[model samples]
Target chain A: MSRIVLRNLVKSYPGGDRRATDEISLEVADGEFVVLVGPSGCGKTTLLRMVAGLETPDSGSVHIGDTDVTSLSARDRRVSMVFQSYAIFPHMKVRQNIGFGLMMRKVPRPEIDRRVADAAAMLDLSDYLDRFPSQLSGGQRQRVAVARAIVVDAGVLLMDEPLSNLDALLRLQFRAELKRIVHQIGTTTLYVTHDQAEAMSLGDRVAVMRDGRVAQIGGPLEVYDSPADRFVGSFLGAPPMNFFPALVSDGPALSVGALSIPAPSSLARFAGRTVLVGVRAEKLAVSTDAADGFLPATVEVVEPTGASVLLTVRLGDHELKVQAPPTFDTRPEASVWLRADPSTMRFYDPETSLALTV
Target chain B: MRRFALQVFCVAISLFMAAPIYLITLAAFSSRESLNEFPLPLVPTDPSTETLSGFLSSTGVIAGGVNSLMVGLNTVVLALLIGLPAGYAVARYAFRGRQPYQLFLLLTRALPIVVLSVPLARIFLTTGLYDTTYAVTLLHTALALPTTVLITAAVFVAVSPEQEEAAQIFGASPVQAFVRIVMPQALPGIAAAAVFTFVMSWNEVLGAAILTLNQRTLPAQVLSTLSFSPLAYRFAGGFALVVPALLFIAIMRKYLLNMWGTTLK
Candidate 1:
């Protein structure tokens, strides 16, 4: 099936309190592109390394295409890795870099040339094939790295933050190109990145990681709209999700200090108990009228970003970021009402931080 | 203003290093009669090849020079053959005792040559390699190895470990990855180490003197008789010794400066 299965993996560095990767298990179906996204040191890269056989787990097994590959070395496992630094064999020309794997596998000379040419053509690197990495631009060098990875047609491709090294504009451009190529080629890929936005746009399914464990694994929007915990909600959004504590009251409402609002019915059983409320900036709409579920807030700052205006609003003692349409003219210190849909807001147990399913 | 001052500082440093070499060359070429004058003329006065020719034609001079060249070249080969892999191990692997092992390699350099030479000479005498280039070659290799290993290891460390990992991921075995990925990129460092080893072996006198008698290297030949020889002959010997080392550096200057290629792209 060419599927990748990582079973109960655990790895720890010397003298570290927490494992780099806890008993983590994951699967990547054939032709699927799964991204492991997290904050730095969350073990996403380590887990990907374990799958590629660059790292051996303390206890676990890796299986690829129905064969146990835990004991196999990376060379024998037939997986290609694109390193974050591009690692483009700086000494070699672009043509040789793309053909290196086939050469090592003892492919015939003409066949290596043909495959390298094909890869170069696919990556739009035909003109630069004779140039060394030093002669190419940063974005072009990364294309060579990707070309090198895909030329071998390895069943699985492991990329460790391949786009993180590029500048913002180049990164955005490469992101779309990479997704188009990966989907067209249908190679199973396990990509690791600290940037959550890249994870959202590229992966068929995204696995959010925290403290060496998978926090949540689902389709990007599914995880974004309904996070498994406070960490995932705060991590995946731009400007991030706003978090504040609220008390569930028997009035079938939530109370944050003096302000009271209707609560999602799922929290009715937990009345008088504290819950952490999470809301994305885009989810909170600014209402002109005192409509249902509208809370009084004072606009603290207005930041116009062309397409939308980002407003920092103070509701009681809490500061919440609200994304408003650019046409909405609101200045600092202006009193306004912000409305949030009860179903769109996520609630978690205050101490445990686990989401309360509604 | 700052750039001009920095340029003057750099020029001053270069001149300070080059002055002795200039004086040595002038003294070696001048006739003995001109050298006898107080505060001798500094600008190639009475230019002659008499003293240098005399030194070159002395007993065992040509053979000793040839022997020094062979020993220097052999030492370069032997040290690199043994040291490169040891250096690669230190650079790539994180096994137990890795730090201590590198420190231990450096510590071996602290042992005095006087202490090592006697036992080494005795062993060579028993092994029938005494008074031969091989005995001197082996001794020089020992002296050159620590520098070779440490410098190459530093260079290997500069090479992104990701490149080697990328090679292995692409299908090269560990050894193959080092050959195909690490070695090509490590050439400039290897060249630098070679330059240092060649210069050290060509100039080293104490070990060569103690270890070999009839079959002496150029440095040992100069040391044995230069005390009784005239001042002009001594200058000639110094000039001769400096030329080859200078030539080796000049030949290797290109690789030494082109080291930034190994860094990540």
Candidate 2:
């Protein structure tokens, strides 16, 4: 029944001119999983630390369930944290590490042992209960960290880039495992990571932070499909959404160089002004046929990533990336036709960078 | 061929280092008559317990041994008690003048012990603590504290702060986090620091000699009385002085290994 609420949390380091976390406010429902994702130094980690009571906000309050835990120490806050480095006690065996929280609370030895065993079994670590952290592989150590956090049964769990240290294959495998485990435990989790893919896959809701403030927060598909601004649109997707400076004509047609394409009717009000037309790489369809509406371009680079082929194309002075199906064959230096779907195209005001909605 | 040459060179250096200790051991166990015969014996011709037994029985030697042991143990306890927390503070927390404080500790070491010893002796006399093991231990702790702080700080720094934070998040208070997570990880280095402090106190002569009269440490007693003692007694006294230092290292060898080997992951 733990619901987390942050109210205008602002934290700034002494030496830095910029605030580490600036006026961030959000609410997480009971047993909700929310991920804060951004580039490094974007304060996602800072925001999560504030919630865990590891970092104090200069001005604001943090509430967990019904308690205002802003002034409480991390121990009194009743939260469990998983660090990026795992932070497993190297001197202790897996069993002792998992039971450390319960031990700290003066739980009975038998009960501690039972809970440790339960957590170890859940993480598939029962066989290695006697082993030290140094003896385990990277993935196993991460699981041990998770087991340690969950064994405490704290309502709120904070994870800071937990999968960042693992190799790619292991990261993918553990990403699923972590999501499944958190879901099963039903803890209100606030996870911070710089990886957008991890955010999308693991979080029930994704919060995109930039420069110490949350730029956008919504469901993953909602964010990906309708990003709030240019930064959110550009930061969330792979290869990023392409932005082109275009002028909206009387017919609300976007004119890029000598190429013209019909803009969505919603953009008609913004006619006769320069706007940034945003299109996802996957939204741009590449075809060999030079149809009436298709813009002709030369393929500059062809990259095949097993399932999809990414093509870097030159349209006049602009280079646009397009993601096509793996079967689409186009060698570098070949001429191709690019078609933009008007419905998927987003319009942004160049000055404010905010998306323009009808 | 290069590797073989390097190995031979290393062995040669080791033997050179061990030569003095070997000579002392030889003379310590040699009969008094054998030691008196010129051209000091390369090896003990007649190895006997006579010289060691005689040295041990001499006036003040046994008492001095007890005083030295007391001083060394007390010095280590005092130095670590003060130094460990200071070291952890410097390592983990950021404060104004921290760098200057560390530098000041180093600066205290650069000053000759004789400079401090005279004033310290005067104060000890005034305080009615003169000629006691306590006076020697206090001076030795002052000498060892700088090293203790630096070593323990380095050790604590090697233990990741994230681990302590993780511990706190798991319901441990700050002190509990330090005791449970950081302290165990830092034990090896702290043990190494303790050994160093013990050896420093054991081998210290000038401060011990200046600070005490009747309750003189082994080194102070040996140095003060060495001029009149026989060569056999001198060698035996020197050998006796070396024993505790060697034993301290031996006991802490596992921690020393840990300091050099495995990094805390």
Candidate 3:
């Protein structure tokens, strides 16, 4: 139960100009779970490795609680890591794997046994204590990895895509289980994953990363609702946020193809300029009726996903995806009216791809 | 039809390899007179232990056998002690000249041991190590080290670095991690390497024959006495030399399979 902080971390591989992790700084509160989420190669895993002391940053300091641990080896840093492959010692049985750290530190036999039993019980691995790692299924091996980390009682826990190897259903099940276990243990944890859904569901605060930089860091809803840039805005949502090139006119209305909608007053100064407008699929309302402010469109495709139907509508030359109730099914080539809530609309600078205040 | 043909081919190959060893074993157990018979009787009418007893009773042959076992064990121990860490370093770390170093190890195999043996004997004499089992063991280690390093490197490369990192993260030092985690997984392959080293040292003749006089290994002693010894003695000595090599393979067969099978994930 300690805060972990990283300061201005930069790492670059040999013969490469681009830094793997560029000048990134973040802080995790005691018992808080912060997830670094991004696409592969965004350096989220590298950043987590730096915190774990598995990697050394070109220039950075890592602090666990009040002590600087940048120069410390992984063993001296008192941090436990759960790797993507689980990395359970295939030769050791479940009990030995969980009790390894304590044995390494020369803990008393009874104490190690007690702690290992406790962790095994918590992870529902008591029955498999005598079985080797190869005998366990993927999910069970992952639990043994967690139990190994938990029994150490390290101040910080680092996990790198721990659920990426499991099937979708198992990932979902273990995602909730991992959150529950971490919450119960109350260890400050830094988790990394490329899945935005996993990041949102597991993290107390999610840090969205792009190109070795922290694009945005906030609570899940805050990040989803108010992404700091186009990358973050587009990367966080499924059926991702749609962007349309629009012209801001004198009346502060945005014109896209043949349709025009009134813009928020904050964009009045950018009149007559071209800007990118982003709206999430769920934020757009589709109707069969032609309302006054609704833009007319022709439906190109309808996808029903049990809870909701995703409609791909062609608005002039551009297509927009609208999330509609599953009950609201319509054939392709049908005419529909689409409207976006003014408050939920995001405007971005076309050149920089940065979200503009609206 | 295709599967049956393939099985037949494999059986043919097995028999082809086994024929020479089977013939030698039969000659070792038969009377010397039967061995000299026209067709060379495939089956001995009266199996006699006379040749084996005569071979075992010879003082020079007994000393050679003991020397060979000692040299084999010593060479294996020394080669593993020096090669395992070097192999682990090459497999686990990135350093300057790693490729060149491995290439150098491979290149050593191209230089025949005979070319180095005379010079090695001269140096051994100057260093007061000549005509001793230790001199032969040192030369054998040098001969076996290249293969030992390469095999052990391939073995260690199959072990994941993440397993070691997991141990380090769990509060074990790098050395402790290697000892407690990496070494256990690598044992089977190391055993295979040791077996190879032992059999190699046991059967090597040119270097041992040139390097040692009174303390010659079994193969060296057998080669030096080949022209003078009776034919029954030759067959008995060949069978005796092949026995230990076969036993080493039998002991290490499981580990050899494991060594090849453990490809890192």
At residue A345, give the lDDT of candidate 1: 86
Please give, for residues B237-260, the per-residue lDDT of candidate 2 as tens digits: 999988877887788887777665
Model 1 pairs whose backbones collide: none
Ranking by lDDT: 3, 2, 1
Candidate 1 per-residue lDDT, tens place, A1-358, comes to 2789988899998878999999999999999999999999999999999888889999989998888999999998878889999998989999999999999889999999999999999889999989999999999999999999998999998899999989999999999999999998899999999999999999999999998899999999998888899999989988789888999998679887777888878788888888899999999989656766678899999999998999999988889999999899879998889877787789988889999876
Which residue pairs collide in model 2, if any?
A: none
lDDT of 2: 0.90
DockQ, all models: 0.85, 0.83, 0.85
List candidate 3 stretches off by more than 4 Å: B96-104, B262-265
Error of 1 at B142 (Å): 2.7
User: In model 3, how large is the Cα lDDT of residue B55?
Assistant: 82
Q: Return the DockQ of model 2.
A: 0.83
The sequence of per-residue lDDT tens digits that candidate 2 reaches over residues A294-313 is 88999999999998999999
Residue-level lDDT tens digits of model 1 in B1-265? 9999999999999999999999999999999888899988889868999999999999988999999999999999999999988887777778888878877878988999889999999999999999999999999999999888877877888788888889999988888888888888888789889888999999999999999998999999999997798999899999999997799778877766655444311
